[model samples]
Target: MATTAISADTSARPAAWPRALLLIGRVALGLVFVVAAYTKLHFNGAWHFSDYYFFFGMAINSYNMVPFWAVELMGRVLPWFEVALGLALISGIALRWVGIVASVLLLAFIGGMARAYVLGLEIVCGCFGNSEKLGPLTLARDGSLLVLALAVTVGAFLIKKRAERVRAVLAARQETVSS
Candidate 1:
């Protein structure tokens, strides 16, 4: 058996345009999550930290709908989850899974915010701390983040689908030639 030289073109490039866009979205989402988490972690004072925590408590309790401990846990871990998701997005490892998870998380946040808004709760949103306010404007901002997360999911899946198609075509050609 003789070995044949493979052309350089046979090697895959680092990333194409679609992958680049996906990467950018992932990084941007990750940064936002990280920043939000950072703001919460470093927040101080009676209103900034305490008011946000109290509002979250209200949401989890559903205005006295659920348990108090559950509300506390929800308030405590929410920021950490965002931070973790952001790190995963930035790492680009298991991006497909991460993007999907991030999208779901965003949807959950949107729903919570919407519910609180409908209940006529005066909240800070705490998404970006006291800097940002709640209401239609905040909902729009949350929706925008969700949109980005969904785009990241779609883009990542598209890349994977393209890779699978290319692999299938190459395999089929190889089979036909071998036969």
Candidate 2:
């Protein structure tokens, strides 16, 4: 009878491809958010913040799903929030929580778009800016973003677990050797 030995090396570690994929997804999602924020904030050949706000608020109001007060507040705040979230994601900081937040935001956007589509309200999406109309394309894009955010979140947790397991195994081996 032949006995085979299993090597307890880093070869037993988690695969790198999954981490790479996670990084790619994170970066892609981050870029999308940053671009969306930029579009909302940008003014053509001018830097009029109030104009941007008014237009964005109008876009939000066009959905008719929220109160005027809420529209004003969201117009003022949402773009900045998106910028922060996007930068966090790109920097890979606090990825697990960031991913969750990103996913939630995308879900909310999708829900709003869906509602607008169902109600037959031809409104600007207020997503990328006043240019994007609420339609199947907008919904599909948001849905894709939600999927990417979710995958990144799940991958982050899985990677964390794998690292913990690896650490435990290494500690156990060290103790055995000392004994």
Candidate 3:
């Protein structure tokens, strides 16, 4: 029996560019996190430490959104998380989970910037590092990151879904022939 031809365009050829773009996005986000953590822990000194400490404290003790202990734990752990996620993205392992975690972090950053903007607080986003100023423009700058994180998330999802579909199709064909 003659089998129907599978179109060349239909097969998921391993494209270098998509992987490259995803890697870029992952590294960018990861670098941002690692740098932000480093700056807060080092360069900006007391003020940066104070800012992060208070910010996290509020999230835990005051806001009651994320637990106080959890926020405290993140204060020490976030930078490492960034480093790990960045490495995972660049290494091309578990891309989907990395994308999801990055997305969540970006969303949180956006929310913080938006809150500061609305509250009329003259604060630096402390995104890349501590700065003297922040405003709607800064928030917009962070929004771009949210967009990038989203793109990465979607790309990872698509790749995984396509792989799943291909595997399912192959398995079905095998079953049919065996019976």
Candidate 4:
């Protein structure tokens, strides 16, 4: 009988640079979301929280897409939601699902902005705040965000899959050695 040795090599593992880039992308996207939420919630030197929500609601209403009730609900919920999502992204927690959620949110935002622009509805974007106008710039910015989100999402999944494969290979090698 002949005995063969199985060598453990990490050369087939994913590169470190790609992981670094993914981290950078994730943190950057997270910061953007956090800042956006802050802008929406900030009082701009005012002391009234309701005042901020009122203006935010107006911005949502300008789209003329949803009813007043939905506008009220979204206006009140979205900033906090952004804050939570941003924190999750920054913490690198459940990144795959978070990335998906972020991408979907960005898509919805872009769609709304495109609709408002195409219809020539002059309205505040209500993105960062009630100040930004819905125009080419807003659409472009959101579109870029969507792209970033998608890239991060794809990268995350790829890394996860690679890790799984590496683990499987290692496990099989161990089993062979033991046998």
- RMSD to the true structure for each prediction, in A, is 5.6, 2.9, 4.6, 2.7
Clashes of 2: 0
What C-alpha lDDT do the candidate models reach, one value each?
0.76, 0.85, 0.66, 0.86
- lDDT, candidate 2, at 179: 82
Task: Give lDDT tens digits, candidate 3, residues 42-158.
Answer: 653554544565553333333234666777886656655666776776666787887888888878867766766677766555555545366777778778877887898898888
Per-residue CA lDDT of model 1 for 1-179, tens digit only, reads 11121223235543578888888999999999998877765655433544456555544554343477878887777877888989999998798999999999889878878988888987667677544567899899889999999999989888998788667656655765688
Model 4 TM-score? 0.91
Ranking by lDDT: 4, 2, 1, 3
CA displacement after TM-score superposition, residue 36 of candidate 1 (Å): 1.0
Please, what are the lDDT tens digits per residue for candidate 2 over residues 1-179? 11111134545678889999999999999999999988888856565567677888898888888998999999889888999999999999999999999999888888888988999998888898677778888888889889999999999999988888878767766666678
**Candidate 2: what lDDT?**
0.85
Separate clash counts for every candidate: 0, 0, 0, 0
The residue-level lDDT of candidate 1 at 14 comes to 38
> What 10-residue stretch in candidate 4 is worst by lDDT?
1-10
- Show the lowest summed lDDT stretch of 10 residues, model 1: 1-10
**Ten-residue stretch with the least lDDT total in model 2:** 1-10
